[model samples]
Target: MRTRLMEAGLHDGATWRISPTPFLLTSADLSAIQSLGQHLLRFTHALNRLYYESVRGAQPTWVADYLDQGKPPDLIAYARMNRFRTALPGVIRPDLILTEDGFMISELDSVPGGIGLTGCMGQAYTDLGWPIIGGRDGMVAGFARMIRSLHESREGAHSPVASAEQRVPAPLPNPPQPSAARLAIVVSEESKDYRSEMLWLAARLREAGLPAQTVSPDDVIFTEEALFLAGSTPLTALYRFFELFDLKNIPKSELIMYAVKKGHLALTPPMKPWLEEKMAFALVHHPALEPFWTHELGADTFELLHRLMPKTWILDPRPVPPHAVIPGLTVDGHSVSDWKVLASLGQKGRRFVIKPSGFSELAWGSRGVSVGHDLPQTEWAAALEAALASFHQVPRILQEFRKGRHVAVSYHDPVTDEIVPMPGRVRLSPYYFIAGEVGTEGASAGPPSAKSVELAGILATVCPLDKKLIHGMTEAVMAPCTLA
Candidate 1:
């Protein structure tokens, strides 16, 4: 397996600890995780609607204002257009921290990496006779299905729903043949690290008889009529691997957006900058938006999300009025009026996390993240002040930190050639694909399709116990989640 990963160039030039086996999950854990995808999909839909309604005066205007901050006016207007307003991300991956009781969703990634890496890991483990969560080729098949569904929807065809048992990797249904439609997974230079893995994925899709390929933004052939990888190979849909903030640097970004805006092509994730914000989590926990979320997500889902989502707040710099205090936030049983009070608290009192909200280079990959308890008093205060100061240009969010439960994992020591036990905390990233047809007119306001959210694969990153922030690093043990 180590040789296969290295040869495939899926490690992104970084070597990680090799686990002897897949991370095992209990049956109960499997049940709870399988149901989480649909709820998240619903949340995305509701968030889209809330923003549009806020713009139209049906809801609070501040909701839209908050999301529109720090974003370019032209791009915001393009996202709010009627042609693409019904669109949502075709793929969703939530960062879940495994606790003693359950898991908490730290954040969601729309244009997430690790899809190809996780798919390769799943196939490798399944080949070893492990009962992987999404079967042998679930990730590849799920991704193909999503692209095919988008293509079919654009061609005015109804997408066939898959059975619960058939959610795993399976043969594509034969109703609306999408063999002729090509898919281009466009990776920008900023995202060159995962380019090799995406190339591997495109090859697998081609092997499955789907016309898919990975290309850089420069390789895309743009004409007034449509987009193509070359003059002859016309693309039906595109999977954007780059973030919206980096569009200025990406080659032919305007051409690609023009193609989608003119109805010449379809793009997954819809280029909506607001949908990519981490502040959406903070919006979910807002008291003023409780009725909106509960109405859209229903009582049961609302309750479930409340339990699973950590309390979060957007670091707004404006001073609080003397007559009022921040909602749902208090220190020492007193409603706090200012943000600096928390910075002055001791380590035990400041169990929180500060990070960029979104639309910035530091938003992803744990780049500008600071854990309050892990830092000194002076450093924590600086982090808080900096976060508040950057509100207008690059927003930041403060979240209640929930520590992961300690677990024992065994890995093969390359030098010693012996199994070694390591104590660590786990972060599970389950890739969910929205495979159902996305309607153009009423899809955003309608209920979520039961079969749309398909759980393809789960990647577990077990960091050493000493590491407070869990991410893909050289010291972490990377493996796929599986049943015992």
Candidate 2:
């Protein structure tokens, strides 16, 4: 490796001078990751179905309203369109904290970061002849496959729905691929953290003779014929590199979705905000909805998910009856009637995490999280009060905190130019890439179609165990994971 390249490290824009060598996972670890992908794929399908069913009075009215709140009406309706009824995000990355027992998935992201970072690092390491997990081509191929599949799904023939009320997929004719359709990744200003990595990814794809590049939403120009970047490049498929919450800030962002709705463009993470929330995990643990989840996703899948997901409860600040207690929570050694009482929990009782529901800037990164045990009593109380206060607008959830076990890994010490050993907590974010036909034959089955969700790549962030919040290149060692 060149000295300049080593000095630059993984920075396209964000600088990460971590090890050039990747972290190695055990084969058993790999198997567990693959199993997680299969289960989550089925879980998301069932969750989506459950959401719509709840909207139709099969469940509760608050379900749909909670997910749809603060979303643009047109986009909500567009998301619910029969054309997108079966649509799932092609890329799924879950934040898995490695505890002594195993892994506890803390968060799931549809529009996740680390894709381009994972791609660039994996490709670089693969070029060095190392056996990287998910292979060197995993991220790139996964993304390209997603684009291609989304393009085909949108262009294919549609089956007429029995009624507007019924949201079943109506498959239409399969449109042939365009001879010269182009691909570009459009990033919004809010997601500049990964812009450079995406550009590097595009350059890599271009070297392999693919039409790929990264463009900002501001650079996109729409015409009666198609949506073009810089007025000359017609985009057949677009991978949205921005979050749904910040789309309004992008110049002419509305036009891109308009283009998608009019058949001039194909976009994904598919303008679906519901899938982007962290609160979906809490819904999976809802006892009242367990039957619906089991019916939509078979009992075995539900059981797996139940065991996988930690105990979580959506925090609603509505006052409880004097005789009633909040499920799974207590204060002062008794059932509590008020939400404010949660703020006074002592250090021993603060073994939980407070997270936002989503649709806000706070939803991304570590900004929206409050690690109870890590904070002082006053600070913890204050954070809990703030979260409770935001119940109506920005909902929050409390999840049982799972402590990550310390693991030893070596990192590149740029100062000494040496590889040194360090013990840190691991956050395993495995990128499960969905390809081929994503339409699951039976979401209620035990596992999803294994071929649909493939193990694209794994990103391991090993941060100092002392650090409560893990993210970015700060003191953390970021690397592509391998089962070598």
Q: Which candidate number maximizes lDDT?
A: 1
TM-score of model 2 vs. true structure: 0.89
Tens digits of per-residue lDDT for model 2 on 293-329? 8887789888877877788777777778877766656
lDDT of 1 by residue, 1-484 (tens): 7878888897543478888799988888878899999999988888899999999999999889989989999889888888777788889899999999989999999999999999998889888889889988888888888777676566552224644343232334733244765889999999999999999999888877688889999999988987887755778888899999999999999999888877666688778888899888888888889999999999898888888989999999999999988878888789888998998999999999999989999999889999999999999999999999999999999999999999889888887789999999999999998866564421222357633788999999999999999998898999999976
Per-model TM against the reference = 0.94, 0.89
**lDDT score of residue 268 within candidate 1:** 82
lDDT of 2 at 444: 17
Candidate 1 clash figure, as a count: 0
Query: Residue 463 in candidate 1 has what lDDT?
Result: 97
* Residue-level error in angstroms, candidate 2, position 56: 1.5
Q: Pick the candidate with the highest TM-score.
A: 1
Off by over 4 Å in 2: 1-9, 12-14, 158-181, 231-233, 330-337, 438-451
The residue ranges of model 1 lying beyond 4 angstroms of the native Cα positions read 12-14, 157-178, 439-446
The CA-based lDDT of model 2 is what?
0.73
